[model samples]
Target: MGIEWAEPGSSGHVLEASMRPVDSLQHSRATPVRARMWKFSLPLRHPETGRLFADIDHLGAGLQRRSIDRYMWLIHDRDEGSAPHVQGALRLSNSRTSTQLSSILGLPSTALRPLRDRSGQHGAFERYCRYLLHESPEAQADGKFHYPDSAVHANFRFRDMIDRYFGLADSGCVPTAESADQIRLKVYNGDMTPLEVHGRHPMIFIRNHKSIEELYYKGRHDRLIAAALAERAALKDEDARVPSTDPHAA
Candidate 1:
């Protein structure tokens, strides 16, 4: 006898088999993302010296994203009306968790410090930073600053490595007149180069509201925010409904 195959739509058994795989898949779904926690040591400057430094044990969680640049002379001068006065600003620098920068650059951390105050169009720091990447290193030892282009985000990663051990010089309103003068000597007139700023306030990734907000898209952000609030309210309602276990009183 010749084998007779059922028409595609006529076979209930075939459809059931097809849905079995999907049904099995539904039971093994992944868990939703959980909030991340982090820690960071609170840093402060010496009231007198304005020297900045942080010990090893600081960590904070935030959705890791590149911070926006700010604190330019132009921004300070323009009156933006309602924009919040520049309460503060953050500067990013390249750093290396790898020894690649150190091995290639030869200059390492110590050499970079002396040139930290580069500004006024011809600062030693920028020159050295660019120079090392080009002149030294492995196969491209002669390339010099080859990575500074958009591909490497300049020396940001290398700069981040330097971020590990850094110092700070306070420039904004000071606690006293003497301290203010010290800042003037140590810090630029709110024009400190990005390197100096980075050492002062090392990049932090904190898992605060901003981190959560950023993870969602523009429209989704609002919806998620409202949903989270509602979920929290429902939890509170559930807590209120739980019966107390005071059997003796009853």
Candidate 2:
């Protein structure tokens, strides 16, 4: 069963879903979680800087500490030259209703949208991951896979965290059809090829020279490579001053 949305009213958006007990037997099955996933989007601003919220790491950690089972946050501008906003999905393991979850997140009820997957399809979490990362078949066919510079804050590590939480393993065995599908969903939306996606983890690929050049420097690969090399040399020089036995030595 999936979430059913209430009709719009003066009360704003209200999420309604049938609650299901945590099925222990499902753990042995291929499906991920029995819990439903809710997507949230809200504008957050830094009071001092007048920019987007910049402490997503702290926000994510706080949510996890509050017993949120799994979550992923993506910060991006709403439009060209517009202020950035935060959007993501979360899975609740407890009995808290959607209203309660919104309260805990300091967001109005309208911000939450319950995700529903088609019959015999991937779980809601996987669906949201593909949609947000622009890896879904629909997104690919439409050529709508693009994110702004603010998308640099997109947390790919959370995908790995969610996989681990669900006990999904990435064994280095030969790729099956299922494994190939998983790789497609996990590939970055940037200019990376399948070979590159297979070679590096998503987290590392996000911050590597190629991604930095394409995302931030507008594909100035040569300039970016030179800067990266210079920075590495400077870091080595700084490391030489540290004693080998020092715990802080790089």
Candidate 3:
């Protein structure tokens, strides 16, 4: 409810994830030798009835939208946490209808032009209407997904959030340590401090929305920038580890 949307996996911040800030994770305490845990059970009192009817039919996939919580719970039996959902969450807004649907989805509209601008992860974009009209919920139904509009428009802004959340930066296209050290050395030799250096990076700017300490992740650009800077600094450190080639010594 804090940041959850009225619809499942719809537009809005994920409530669960927001509650626990990433900064706190870095300073988590070690587990206790033994901690007391308790369990409790509550009984649900319903009206007098011989049996309860299962709503399996009402549960299957159709066009029913609920808050992300109810939806993730239905799929994984656990919460996937919440994400920020802005107005861009809904692509069908009356005013934004004219906006390029492809851009919103983070894909070039012309990229699939030969196919008539058709899109569907599992093939639903063009066939969406067809599915709704012909495919009954019972006979055959498919699910369609779209990225948050903010990502398409302001991807750089959420770079930190995306990288940390997905853990892709560490293993994926990262700059070498030498590169990181070089960046750090450059920043140090320049007229800027660490804080200033971070400020200048595109990634930092994106994550440093309201405050630098408590930054909100907008996308992956931040990770890329940070990695590059880090690699430069690491490079400089490597160079320093060995003695400089001295003409007077062997």
Quick one: best lDDT, which candidate? 2
* Residue 68 CA displacement from its true place in model 1, Å: 31
Candidate 2 TM-score, C-alpha based: 0.43
TM-scores of the candidates are: 0.16, 0.43, 0.15
lDDT of 3 by residue, 67-95 (tens): 11111101211113322221111212122
How many Å off is the CA of 220 in candidate 3? Answer: 30
User: RMSD per prediction, one decimal?
Assistant: 28.5, 14.5, 23.3
Better of 1 and 3 by lDDT: 3
Return the lDDT, model 2, position 53. Answer: 30
lDDT of 1 by residue, 1-250 (tens): 0111121112211122244565436523633221111111111222234433221121111112333121110011121222211111112244322122223222111111112333544323333433332312331433322332232222134333222221121222222222222322333323332344234332211101232223323435556778899999999999889987888856
lDDT of each: 0.27, 0.49, 0.28
**Deviation (Å) of 191 in candidate 2:** 19
The C-alpha stretches of model 1 lying farther than 4 A from their native spots are 1-121, 127-230, 233-236, 239-250
lDDT of 2 by residue, 51-137 (tens): 443345545654654457667667644334334556777766664555666546665444566766668765667656545655333
- Which runs in model 3 stand beyond 4 Å of their true positions? 1-6, 9-161, 164-195, 198-200, 213-250
Residue range with the least summed lDDT across 10 consecutive positions in model 1:
68-77
Best by TM-score: 2
Task: Give the Cα RMSD of candidate 2.
Answer: 14.5
